[model samples]
Target chain A: MSPVNLSNNKIKLSEVDQSMKWAGLLFIISATLWLLAGTALGMISSYKMHNSNFLANLEWLTFGRIRSAHLNAVIYGWCNNAIFAVGLWIMARLARTKVRHLGLLIIAGIFWNIAVTIGIIGILTGHMTSVEWLEIPTYITPLLAISYCLIGVWGIIVFRDRQSEHIYISQWYILGALFWFPWIYSVAQIMILFEPARGTVQSLTNWWFAHNFLGLWLTPMGLAAAYYFIPKVIGRPIHSYYLSFLGFWTLALFYSWAGVHHLIGGPVPAWAVSLGITASVMMVIPVLVAAINHHMTVLGHFREVIESPTLRFVVFGALSYTLVSFIGSTMSLRSVNEISHFTHLTVGHAHHGVYAFFTMIMFGSIYFILPRLIHREWPSKILITCHFWFAALGITIMIVALHVGGWLQGLAMNNPELLFIDVMKGTIPWLKARTVSGFFLAIAHIAFAINVFWIVLSVKNKPAVIGTKALFTSPHAK
Target chain B: MDWYYYILTGFVLAGLIFISAVYAFHWALKNGQLKDLEKGASSIFDDDEPLGEQTDYSLSKSNYNLHTTTANESSKFIQ
Candidate 1:
């Protein structure tokens, strides 16, 4: 708060950014490559859904393997890499500490990506484990765990060496996720893959791991970005510190328990199913708390949200978090899960959480962080706008088509009088719509990738040529 | 093979979460982290990236000058 402290803080912040530069750039660039790869595979998978013969000739491109590969590429490849770039940078900044041992971190990052590459290759090459989220082959799994441990440990070390006496809310979320991921990932690996749990316990553990990976690992990191950027961009504090505290703890407590709801209607016991359902429903408390906090902080910043690219993407993600979490809670109910479970609706819901909420927030964070990390402005505004609209519109169409088609499909299937062919026939149109939506997403990602590389390749310290107006000019300057 | 596998897995996972959560909460309370809600909320902002200042936007010639000035000033620290 003091003048000298402020100056010192600025220097510290710069130091933090400098420390993250090479490693952060490496993570982000790798993430972009994976994003393109994953999106292409996703398009192929979507097309195969409607027209099965599109890639029927290739054994590795078989629908099942391709779909699993796409999932891993996006999850482990794109999302994790982006998380490393954005999440770690944020952690370093909030902790007010310089990230030391950049070489180790970079090596960990490289190994993590290498492991993912090998895992995706293994999945496609008939070495997949057949487990839902653990499709990556058993041999490659330990490398991933080890690489992740190396990367995740850096976050903890940063926290341990933090200069700030009062821990910020973002730090809490990042720290919690840093700790939670390894525990869940390793446990899932040991129980479900390495040791091989018996019978239905395997399925139960599979769902537990898969859901917690999303809920605990990805969700927290995404929320951490949203919490930090929304307020930081608008130049305001979060609406209520108490609400953030409540949101975080509640999410931690309930989300881990809610994974079992995925096994409803399975061989899992009634009590376990009930516990999952209860936990899933109880998740509303945290979701609502976060929604209120985020929306309230951005209450009158509509103009800023429009002007600042970072605010725009982050705000969109923050809104989607509210929407997706509520939908997820609703879907967890026995009545709803019975309808939505196996239908394309669940697929839509997954994208709603992962792509719309988590991915969008990451996009926004990159927009903010890259400028500081690289000390170069984004090369083009048109590209950023193009990227936002395409991504936003694409995911919107995908979610609607899948949810509506899936609900209808679910309804028709439940009515046994309806012929099975009719149910399958009804889904083709929706699947085709999904394929169409994939094109929009593809274009969006392309635009984003172009902009990232453009800035990276552009001369540093050069003035931006795209727009003339300052989006975040000082109040006095205006 | 047995039902206790379920219980054991459940208890262990749940216990880890519970113990960790309690520890975090206790540490937070002891460190006075929960006391000053307002200050903690505003802790993210500083003079360089001060509150109410939109620091990032799509770059343009008009804003480019402003950005570069900040860049120049901040560049000193990097060296």
Candidate 2:
């Protein structure tokens, strides 16, 4: 694409109002800080694994602290807050409603940051919950829950007082996630912490909460962005309203029960595991529907996708959802989980969901919002393409390395007589490769941070240039 | 936790029902119920008037007096 100019098309200033700019700017600031925190911790975690004594003496910077810090910064500080802010802001714009109780949103943002701050402190001080994805201490969970409640409440208000009555497809996903997330979170907490539940209930609640975090909350947020950005970029209505609705309902129906599949081969009841397997398989229907709707609708307009970074990331994200769901269901099979469980394969599976699936959506959503929210186009299209390549390559290498390394480890462990060092030797190469490629990913993330910073801070409007280019266009202009 | 499982089982069951209802609503919509929902009430009101009922969803034409204003506007755009 040529030099991107900002003036010709005359941006919708009402869309880029002060409230939007402020909220967008704050989110960017939060994201950059979170990136720094997540990256530093990630590198430490990587290095300390191979060289155990690298940071062994530092109490606050131990591997566990860094891991929890990394997770919290990336998930809560970086990903969720940023997406929630952008999602709610965009919904307001599309619904043609002014932001309500602006002070409340700012206060909520403060509460959000405070909660993360305390969570990070607790994790570093060895006060973690020790549960994967529930590492934040009990004291901090209430704060995060309250902040989320406020944000969801604001969304309901904005959606309720809309200019138009016909609810858009995007609203369905966002609204579902907004309401459903609390149900999953609160129930899990109440059972796990406050009141002890009966036999197998803790594991059931744990898996239920963890699964819904992806299925109900993260997926909906991503899908909402998908439903909105896809049509907005393509400049066409969804191929079929019926199909979009079908995908929504099927996902809600099927995604919940599948959480139990994660506990396959564990002490969970037989019926529960079977139910999870059934639901996991049933998830294919919604996945297929959404895939066809997103991919087919953009089929004839391939050129636009090539030039547009937003579309590129979103398409990758949309495709990854299919791949991840497929992988998730397959891994749930008893025979498969027997080998893959407790192996790095599970790590690869997770990255497929988190980095490949959800983070891609976050990346795409940020790209789509930066221009509208900040009133400036990205500094350069080349940087955007470079960022995607590095990220895609990094995640690709990480997952493949882990999968292969894990299969070998699984084989070695099965021998029972094989030395643990033998398993380590086989996987060490991949772990090293993961560290190396992760550096590239770190750079890509920094590149993205820079791009975001420029968009939010730069205000001098330049001459507008046509920017109909899709993301993966050949760098022939090189 | 045992009691919680029972509650979760209820949640699971409720979620299934909710999703089914949403699908059913969409099925009705796909069958062209929502686009014509305005007619459900408007037709009742139109009965009192001498104008004909809205038999089709071709809002492109000002075929009825009750909707002549919207139909006429659409006709101008069609040109």
Candidate achieving the largest lDDT: 1
**What is candidate 2's CA lDDT for residue B8?**
67
lDDT of 1 by residue, A128-225 (tens): 98888889999988999999999999888988878776788888999999988888888888778777778788888889889998999999999999
TM-score of chain A of each: 0.96, 0.91
Could you tell me how far off, in angstroms, the CA of residue A208 lies in candidate 2 after the best superposition? 1.0
Backbone clash pairs for candidate 1 read A235-B52
Which digits, one per residue and each the tens of the lDDT, describe model 2 over residues A354-380? Answer: 788778777877776655554445665
Residue A431 of model 2, lDDT score: 81
TM-score of each: 0.92, 0.82
TM-score (C-alpha, index-matched) for candidate 1: 0.92
Off by over 4 Å in 2: A1-19, A461-478, B1-79
